[model samples]
Target chain A: MSRIPEETLRVADRLAAAMAREMRDDRVAGAALPLALLAALLARALYAPDLVVLGSLGLPLAPSAWWPGSGFRLSLARAEALALRHADGRFALEDAFASVFRGRFAIWISPAQVDATGSANLSAIGDWRRPKVALVGSRGLPDDAGHIPMRYYLPRHEPRHLPAAVDFRSAPGRTPEDGRRGRRRGGPEVLVTPLGVFRFRPEGVVADSLFEGVTPEEVTRRTGFPVTGLPEAGRTPPPTAEETAWIRRLDPFGIRALELLPPREARLAAAAIAEAEGEGM
Target chain B: MLASLTDVAARVREASKAGRLVAFGGSGLHRKPLRAAEAIAEAAVPDLRLLAPLGGPEVDLLVLAGLVRRVVFSYVGFEFLGVAPAFRRAREEGAIEVEEWSEFAILAGLRAGVLGLPFHPLPGPATGDLARTAPLAEVRSPYAPHEPVAVVPALAPAVAIVHVPFAREDGTAFVPGDPYADRLVGLAADELFVTCDELVGPGEVPGPALFLAAEVTGVVPAPGGSCFTASPPFADLDVRGAIDYLESVEARLARPSARAAPGRAGGGRGR
Candidate 1:
């Protein structure tokens, strides 16, 4: 932020307003606003692509509506949706995750599991209700693109300050069964819970806490998901509002991939869309 | 062969039979009923089986009205159609078969049967548990590496009825986008009949190249069925309607298929 030239800064009105609206807590409001402003300002200068790091806010917020295991119960339904629609394997999941972990994909786990991770996983970027992210297996987007809609599910708990347990299936990496069956080839590093934020490292371990603004405790309390640990201390900033706006205007920045929403939600949304479409309105 | 959306609707309505089921969809998907193509579906599919991937409130009127019987699909299309009470009832009663199928497999299966394959191996991403849960993915040689065939048992209908914006006299048809699955249904059918809003010759279309292959056997010239599919030259989509349709289909698709041998029985023969 210090290096950014003053003239290059994009207005932070939308970002600021969104933050203000999203975070009702005053205590954290000051810091979040400034951080967002600074990051957005800095993003004006940095080549967003060169910015290997991302300060994803899908992370825990002071008052977030998302959590880790929120998708856990919904996993069955979500998994069912994916299985049903994806059995043929035409579209790719935004997140390369296996929902059941050790079991087959069901719509619900025990209520106990839901209590473990609190977030609902509805906090995907932009308007995407069921977001998916993937590697640029193809060539990267245009150089100026800002965000790659990489949908990852950070566990509710990390080794330490973990406020939430994350779902890794939402990240990179192929599930074991998928590997055995040769379905999804690999696994994801970081995760984007409806609440928590994460980033991947070259080392393969998902370093937590990519959303610089919110804390695990705050996020956990807000989203009811326990997000543990910050990234190895120095996380890269996210694209500022200017960069985001620029990318939106100049390029199709985000990855179009996303995973299925919890079954109930997905069913509802798809039904709404389908029904509306069927009506021919 | 030349017909309009309304003409197509009459054909579909005529194709309906009691206690018999037929799958209906187009390459151009729609969630709303206002579009002429979807209207064709509404007009044709009601009081019969609306066999789709899913259902929702959107088509509840169709469902509850007893106009729609059972819907089979992956997701509820309620949002697309408009919320309805009938679909919900069907779901509660365990009437719809929502077994999932991969987007590709759905198309490929139809294609394979049309192309003269017993089953086409559909080895791809099974996002939800539909592959294991759905009957569509159950086959002797599903995605076998050697053949990699997705056993698309011939989805031959007593009548492969479709509503397009354009129906040509030479059995050529046109719809929006590359309606690949429609082509599959067109080819692997005992008969391919169509209804449309307008009838056009090869001269009316961009070129003869745009017409589907010969498999689109019978071109029944009818108009006004372009409501669901967004058959171009007649209409485009409002997107909101598409969203609503997505939701309805999602709901209707909630029912899983009773998994059996993929092609245990069917109207058409597989390669």
Candidate 2:
């Protein structure tokens, strides 16, 4: 494993700890924290003086209304309320989607699986006639990836999740060559996984940065195919203290901490248990 | 006139008898017409084909009860809870057929239906192999013959069942959240049935009209009708209940003897 900077490790630890602390509560769902944190990050990255719609599964209310301690009202209704409050006028949902497709807005989606080429699968794991696993059908992903600029968030980054090729192409990624069928302006831009960050390139996906303590070898081992053009390994930029504080403010109940910690630690614990069993036996 | 939940189910049954396509609403538990769906499935209407953007417990229940013979949808699984088990079993058993569309295709198809067009042209990968088995046809662009375009045939549901936050006695309804494709489905369907948490007098309706009275065929007051799902201020999705239901269905499906249960045999209502 490549050595991770102490500071970078600390940042991942802190974020994981915060997520762990938030998970203690019974009400919060498993993906809620990471998703909310991702939402907050996206909101921060895209925030501007003018109104820009953040197209997600739903809308996000003001931090005060739906943040961690506020009972976390993360629903379509909450988003709708926020959209109504922020927009200058009313329009149909289709119009909003059309705007997103036209690249007038940005969207964040979580797919079941994504491949090196950026093709996503949310429909099935095997043949269409009878799938080994039937997932929620592809809603909007085809156009979302084909037209709108999208950022994908994968909570778990493993060979199965980030495969060499998705079993079924629910959404087609940008072609390797300039000549392709997708939108001229829109396609996948970035992928955020637990281990590292990647950006889509004409040739293929390239590793932009690794999280603290994650190695290029580790990433490649977990990935289905050999990842190309990994830059001289650098620490992923840690969340700024200000950004951390803003995240805390957005999730007053500390839900992010609780939601993130258990799984992170559980994996470590399992590894430790396996190591001990091997040594002792 | 205000209709009852049973009446709405009967209407759905009538549509089913006529071999009409039915479309429900929403992604998850939010804003779906669950009670009406359950009632329709319980009525044991056969040859029912469903056209929905997303599927939830109601769809699963109908599939398990053998009420739905075919489904044309984007996706069909319980969010977070995992894949809808009954749907998986039915698909595995080849008891039902599916015409899968990407979320974009389903929405675009509905738009085309509303426009009274034969098909809607779409760009990108959805036009590729995914369109092979689907009702999509490829056509050369008049301006650019070298560029191939995909055209998705319009999807017009015979009956659309939608659940909203508020509806007037006159049949116009209001949904406080993202209507998703509910409005388009309503507009594209031959008949629209709306179930609302609150029934209001005409002119007292709030927000924009999600479903116009002229377009809506029936207005039913069904408070908590979307129970175990969500209808906003009326109720939140009963997560515990949903998990319990999933477990129950899973357990029942696991039993060898239970495989021949009345629910799966097209006789009784699924618990």
Candidate 3:
């Protein structure tokens, strides 16, 4: 395995310790401190009753095992993605869209860029006609973002990703345009990043909770746009002992490492771990 | 009568020659008629306009082979595997014409075709960059002019190709799991061609028939047709095969001179 930077290791340890401390102290909500912020947020969301999550989260492990329900409704998933779902049933793309269109499911989207207004850009990085980097074209984001209750998860919290305005608004967010358009059913409820969890308000995006060891000043420095509600923001709650145990049990191989580690390292580490786990099985 | 993969390719080539729109069934990578797609690529059909609700390697294979003229799709990428490198490169280079839509709107278009309607009106918030790029028009309700609805025109493909997990000789086919727009595509197209992984006898199908015998124009019996893609109950996605294809595509992209015929290399492993 490639050696990780000493600084990165120290930072991870510090953050993990802080989260552990908060979990023991507050006991407000349960989150997994050791798991990536994205998984932790998902663990917290799993606590919600009868919730249906749509969209491929791109985690290394299957999320269905982690869900408290009998089955998590996974849709728009390819074979590779559905492979991760374990026992959960798959929904056809059309059926999945129908549910989202009807405002039945809370959709989770990961976008290349998310503006201050909460609009997501999954289409391209530069110009539409000839983009410098053409990402996946707006699949269902354009059709469903305004109508459905949406949550965003960004693995990295940076200025480039959290821009003042997205180059292309693939999905309309909390902007007045969405409200004026009609039937806006609470678009972009929250955005979870490694640094913190942010909620969209009528005013704009604000920090609801910062991750352990992540400060308001760090968030401000990282974000390109102005984000308020940090001064009063509290630490993101850590998962309960039971939740952590569930997470660890389900993901015995640290599959969350794929989301946590850098790209190259992630692939290598995940492969080695998966191989080891496979042999053990 | 059961057809062969060669016959299926010939039919698709004929459709291409007639300047007809061809729709491939499956979203992203699951249950895609990849073997048929590979056969089509081998046939070297030119200037084909392909429509998929959501595509992945099947669409990318054609694009890589330089057989595609235009693509009408909402999304086209291997979900976890990564982006559709060929499709992305083609669109970025303006080598292929693209009509992008939200999944809901495109499916609505397919529905319009299925229902024999000129257009289909979908509810709420379709207006965005995708709507602007797509061929959708806003129409106000005659009684309620205040409420404007975005209507997608009929998407009647000349031919629809699907990979059936389990099928019988008389054309009764069973889709083991999520029927990802396969039935809709079959109904919308003028000609429906099905390729199956397993050709069963009478009362031998593992599940209820999702594709009726009457609707099928041709049935091609090709076992493991959806390899590298998923056709649950029969096979899981061959992850290693998928990764190999992706890596090959990336390798080809790096060396422009090595634009060989994609054939099987660009598609799933022939299990």
Global lDDT scores for all candidate models: 0.33, 0.63, 0.68
- Pairwise DockQ winner, candidates 1 and 2: 2
Candidate 3: how many backbone clashes?
3
Q: For residue A255, give model 2's deviation from the true position in Å.
A: 5.8
* Per-candidate alpha-carbon RMSD to the true structure: 15.6, 8.6, 5.6
**CAPRI class of candidate 3:** acceptable
The 10-residue segment with the lowest total lDDT in model 3 chain A: A25-34
User: Model 1: per-residue lDDT, tens digit, B105-131?
Assistant: 444555565677765544433332233
Q: Is candidate 1 or candidate 2 better by TM-score?
A: 2
Backbone Cα, N, C clashes tallied per candidate: 212, 18, 3
lDDT assessment of candidate 2: 0.63
**Stretches of candidate 3 above 4 Å error?**
A1-46, A52-92, A257-281, B263-271
Lowest-scoring 10 consecutive residues by lDDT in candidate 1 chain A? A135-144
